[model samples]
Target: MSKTPSLARRTKSFQASPTAALDAAAKRLAAEGHTVCNLASGEPDMEPVAAIREAAAKAAMGGYSKYTQVSGTLSLRQAVSRALLRDQGLSYQPDQIVVSAGAKQALFNAFSCLLDPDDEAILPAPYWVSYPEQIKLAGGRPVIVPADAAGGYKLTPEALSQALSPKSRLLVLNSPNNPSGAVYTDSELSALVEVALDHGLTIVSDEVYQQVLYPPARHVSPASLSAAAFSATVLISGVSKTYAMTGWRIGYLASPDPDLIRAAAALQSQTSGNPTAVAQRAAEVAWDLPPEATRHQLAAFTARRRLVLDALAEVTGTELVPPNGAFYGFLSIAGCLRRWREEAADAFCERLLAEDKVAVVPGSAFGAPDAIRFSFAVADDVLKEALVRLTQALRR
Candidate 1:
């Protein structure tokens, strides 16, 4: 008999994301009556502000549950255009925006539109969990450029210079980065942009966490730097992080290259059409949420971030750079790795959950096996309890 419907060769080397896997394990334990503190998923635990929910409900009642323009509703696309100008000093016509199911899909569309087989995409180490898989799925090779936690896990111009090649099609950059929470300064971004331009590299900038930055840190769009830079960058973003609308899945890709934008739209149209109509309407309202509405949530995260830092500071062995944005601590467990004589971060995580009942993502999933990611998106008491459990596990 023929081998049971063999999978494609492209998926042969794929690794399932440990973040989702750990989260499921935590949930399973919780379902089995074991108390579990989950820091595996990156989703904000809060609900969208009332205005957004109300708008979604109203839109649903008004018969907005139909398919939209495949890209987005004209009004929603125009709203995204306006939001870009208002917040990032970036300008784009509505036709240049392709909205998709989530920022994940938007990113996939970008890579699919840009990469042919064997093309290279420069990805900074300790990146978002999904980037490498998405690049591989698009038939591109991910050339990981390592960054150190000591330097805040940031990619420098020198690193970019070393990573680029004639076949390099793009560089994927996420400011207010996931896992690392490293927000690239304007100067840093400017230097990298220079190197990227010199190498003829397209920049896919992920800015989903732009709104959640704390003081002394700011979010700057690389596309806003200059005409050349803007022309070379495709911006990916969504209301998921800022508006606590992960379920809404309202995300878009904006580019000055109409051809790339068109290709993304065509690809999105063939795959996942317009995002949910009700969600699109709610996301449009999210753009108009009261400043205080989001500010209150950011205030909470600020407090929780402090809690994470303080907790880790008291624990020996594990260390982390204080994140300026995003709600995760990319904590180094090198000390614990040595003390426990552990090799793979994945094994350490499995032992951690099975023994201590605390769930944190293995940093190996983010391209750094010597670290683990602890999210501060849950309740204050939950975070407090999780830290105690984490400290206990490392000691074991």
Candidate 2:
């Protein structure tokens, strides 16, 4: 028999998403009759708001099954353009937007369009786990600059400047960042954008969690800083987080550069085509929904953040920086590692799952081996139980 063909070389460069893996493990345990508290995935447990659901059902019943423009429907793109102006104070024509399957695909499309062979994309840790992998898949190197827990895990402009090189082509800024939930202030983003401009690096600002902010912690888009910043930025966001519509899978990237947007659109066309038509219809309504539509989710996450921090305080050997936005808490388990004589965060997570039946992603997946990340998007009681179990695991 002929030998099986090897997978593509790019497959060797990155692993599957650790969050999805851990979530699957949690489900497996639950299926086995174990009481598992899944805090691994960042998906919000809330249902999509009434208007969005109504719009989707209306569209489906109306037979909105045909393909949309590869760049998304004109109406949906117009809605995205208006939303950008209203929320981030960024102006973009509908032609400048490319809606994709999700923010994940929009990011992939951007990287594919921006990176040539051996190009470098600067990423901060603990970043969303997919950033580095997506950059690598697009034939670019990920230049990681790690921020310490003392610094609130927010990357400094000095560190960003130091990471620059002749081959550096892109800088990714995820405000209300995942894993760490480090939301950069307006002034902070201005400094970082200045550094990127000085280096002539294009900025890919991921603002998916822009609406998930708590009071006293505002969300600022780097693209909104100035004309130069707007020109340098590819602003990415989606309805998934704010509208609790993760399964609907609608996201977009808006750029002032027509060439870049066109290239990304072409890449998207050859790959995923347009986002789902019914989902785009739903997302159109989602964009138009009042800010009050998601206020409850924000309120819930704020309370859950307090619970997580308080619980962590009681759990020995864990330190947190008090996330200001997003539904995640990235914890430094260095003390636990030392006390348990453990070296790998992944192993600790595995043991925690096997013993305490709580699931969380190891920070090793996000380029921070000394930490772990848990989502607070679960229901209040579920989150409370998870925190209690997490405390028990750490205390033992």
Q: List the residue pairs that clash in candidate 1.
A: none
Q: Assess candidate 1 and give its TM-score to the true structure.
A: 0.97
Q: Which ranges of candidate 1 are over 4 A from the true structure?
A: 1-6, 11-14
1-396 per-residue lDDT for model 2 (tens digits): 899999987677668888889999999999999999999999999999889999999999999999989999999999998888888777899999999999999999999899999999999988898999899899899999999999999889999989999999999999899988899998898889999999999999999999998779999998888899889999999988999999999999999899998899888888888899999999999998778888888888888989988888756688988888889989998999999898868898998899999999998998899899999999999999988888777787
Report the Cα RMSD per candidate.
Answer: 1.6, 1.2
Whole-model lDDT per candidate: 0.89, 0.91
